[model samples]
Target: WYRQAPGGSLQWVSFISTDSSVKKSEPAMEGRALVSRDNSRSESSLSLRALGPRDSARYFCA
Candidate 1:
């Protein structure tokens, strides 16, 4: 997962795998983001906590 602010380069958020392991790429996201996956459906999700104005950005998953 990644986030891109206006005019800013893409910023790494977290890494998730089918094994259900998550690696945070940014310290700011530690404890503030949650990553989960459902292998049965081949779907994944990202949850953000306590959002604020600064949190506004374009989010992407690859």
Candidate 2:
């Protein structure tokens, strides 16, 4: 997943493998975001905690 703020470049947020393993996450999101995958559903999701005004941004997954 990646996040791009208004007028800012895209930044890495988190990476999870097809097999449901978390590979990486940006230091800034270490405690603020949670990335996970559900193998049975073949799905992935990102959860953000304690959101603030500064958290507004575009999120992408590829």
Candidate 3:
């Protein structure tokens, strides 16, 4: 997962690992944070905290 800042710079964010060996999620970008995670179903879900003024940016997941 990544977030594009106002200057169009892509910042690395939390990473969802499919590998069962890996435990917790990776760290998120500075000033940003992860809010929720739901992996009960086949498809995993991630929710970020409320967006602040600087939080405004285009997000992408791969």
Candidate 4:
């Protein structure tokens, strides 16, 4: 969901979401955006990144 590029215009990167609840009929966004959602309480703690590394990326949720 992120690129290693530093402030350079790049190609369109295909995004994939593992959450079945995350359904998008149509959506478009620009720039760096931190997305968070509490879809299910049972899913309190799970893998944050399935396609890439969670690493030192700073993220937060309510």
- TM-score for each candidate, following the candidate numbering: 0.86, 0.80, 0.55, 0.19
Q: Which model is ahead, 2 or 3, in terms of TM-score?
A: 2
After superposition, which runs of candidate 1 have C-alpha atoms over 4 Å from their true positions? none
Reference-based lDDT, each prediction: 0.84, 0.85, 0.57, 0.33
Predicted candidate 4 versus true structure: per-residue lDDT over 1-62, tens digit per residue = 43323444342222324464442211222223323335466332223333344233432221
Task: Identify the runs in model 4 with alpha carbons over 4 angstroms from their true place.
Answer: 1-20, 23-43, 46-54
| Superior by TM-score: candidate 2 or candidate 4 | 2
Question: Any runs in candidate 3 off by more than 4 Å, and if so which?
Answer: 19-32, 35-44
Cα error of candidate 1 at position 49, Å: 0.3
Summarize candidate 1's per-residue lDDT along 1-62 as a digit string, tens digits. 99998888999988887688645657888888888888889898899998988778999988
Ranking, TM-score, top scorer first: 1, 2, 3, 4
Model 2, which residues run further than 4 Å from truth?
none
Candidate 4: pairs in clash? none
Number of backbone collisions per candidate, in order? 0, 0, 0, 0
Model 2 lDDT tens row, 3-54: 9999999888988878755467888788888888887887788999989987
Query: In model 2, how large is the Cα lDDT of residue 27?
Result: 87
What's the candidate order when arranged by decreasing lDDT?
Answer: 2, 1, 3, 4
The residue-by-residue lDDT of candidate 3 on 1-62, one tens digit each, is 66788777887665656743433434544334542335566554446665667667876765
